[model samples]
Target: MNRLSDKEAIDLLKHGDILELGQQANKIRQEKHPGNTVTFIVDRNINYTNVCLNECRFCAFFRRENRKDAYLLPIETILQKVKETQEAGGTQVMLQGGLHPSLPFEYYLNMINTIKTAFPDIVIHSFSPAEILHFSKIANKSIKETLQDLRSAGLASLPGGGAEILVDRVRKIVSPKKIMTDDWLKVMETAHSIGMESTATMVLGLGETIEERIEHMRRVRDLQDKTGGFRAFIMWTFQPGNTQLGGNKLSSWEYLKTLAVSRLYFDNISHIQGSWVTQGQQIGQITLAFGADDLGSIMLEENVVRAAGTAYQMSIDKMVNTIEKADFKAAQRDTEYNIIRRF
Candidate 1:
């Protein structure tokens, strides 16, 4: 099949029949992954702190430094969480946190090093490009320098957080103080340049036009062409309960249509992950038919979405059953998308 041009993708997203789109996307998925196997990762999102300087309007999780409930988790507490995750048979720990102003560069280096030193087997897929940008300014280092320092301190890879959308117009209205589009791409590019792979993510219903959504994918696809660094593409809806940008969630129909379009648009990227965390189990299951091959993270701990008043729980048994009910073999995967065990 020929690559989808931006106009072609936008047209499909706007007017293509939903089932037909899914059929095309499913065909592509089958071509890439022949067997009826869907993968998931057993991991935990250990947010170290809730203090944030950039108060994004779309976020309900962050708090000012002086707030009574704001916190920075002690290293020992974080280690305990990792220990619990390991005991639960988890192979990855995602250590994300808000951009606290006072913590020195050594805080992150020490945290990553401590986690790695204590748990040598667990993958530390921590931090986002926005946090990396914050670290660079705090440490008086270049982005590349900061990334290299973190990588040296045992940071394995990056999670595709903070990339709500890649269009600056949408970003300005939603998260003006956050890292802009190019900086996000730059951070990912630098990470990929140094062999630290990461995923690409998009959030729908951010009031972005269909063209803007396709533009987001276009940038990611262009970057992947330059650096084959993105391991997967994950998309989900914005939760808007306690957020300053509070509004209704987009329908599952729109989400699935966009997911199918993402499958067709990101032909250069290999995997697409469905968001059970935000969309719940049933829709997560249906995403399989829409071209998603992985259900991301049976997260042992997640607070961002919950903070926004949306929460869904998934256990290993339940996760396996979700995949099995979708008529695909359920398998546990690691941070690198390597199959760890099959159920």
Candidate 2:
């Protein structure tokens, strides 16, 4: 198989032949994995707090400082969630929240330390690029310095949210107040440099062109080529409900095409996760044959993307059943894409 160049990659995606692309992607997947197993993680998105200062246009989750619903989770409540996650046999806890200006730097460090202290076995894959960019502003430190501090404080890796679209023009229109395109990449690059790995994600269908999406993948691939720390690449459609930019959602078919395209393009990224949370369990099952090896977390609790009106419930058993129904073996994994259990 020839490695498709950038232009060839974009052309194949824009051709809009999902079935053909999916078959091509499956070939690549078989060649790479040489196994018929699908993987998922039983995890919880423990949104530590929702009090954010940066009110981006596309978010419906953040509240101002004085909003009645704006409350921070105390240390005890967080531990309680961790206990529930442990009991549920979860191996990952994704801790992400709004960029609250006053939540001092120690607050995040302390939170990670406490989560680690209580549940040392559970992988803590918390904090996205948005939080790190916010932390840099509040702590008056470089992205590298902030990441170093968090890494020392038991922060294992980052989940690439707030990277709605790495194109600044699109970002300016949607999440103008969020970190710029370059800063987002800078944070990830710095984290990779220091040995902390992360999974790359994209919220497509935000009126971005095929070229822009390819460019974003290229950026991720280029960085991964250098550091080799990225574990997986996940892409989902933008849910445009209860937000200022109230556009239609991307159909599951379109989402699959893009996901398959990502698998074909991001050869350096070993795993591609399917988003049952955003796309539903059935299409997510189809995505297994469309170049996705991992079904994303069975989120015990989710908010931000849910706040945008996409709350798809997926239990651990259902996730496993769906994966198996797709004619592949089902396995559970941890945050670093490590296989934990096979069934």
Best model per lDDT = 1
TM-score per model over all chains: 0.99, 0.97
Clashing pairs in 2: none
Residue 152 in model 2: lDDT = 85
How many residue pairs of model 1 clash at the backbone? 0
Q: Which segments of model 2 are wrong by more than 4 Å?
A: none
* lDDT of each residue in 7-95, candidate 1, tens digit only: 99999988999999999999999999889999999889999999999999999999999999999999999999999999999999998
Residue 32 CA error for candidate 2 (Å)?
1.5
**Model 2, position 258: C-alpha lDDT score:** 85
Model 2 weakest lDDT span, ten residues long: 1-10
On TM-score, the leading prediction is 1
Candidate 1 RMSD computed on C-alpha atoms after optimal superposition onto the true structure: 0.6
TM-score of 1: 0.99
Per-residue CA lDDT of model 2 for 114-213, tens digit only, reads: 8898888988888888889888878899999999999888888899888788888899888878888888888888899888899888998888888998
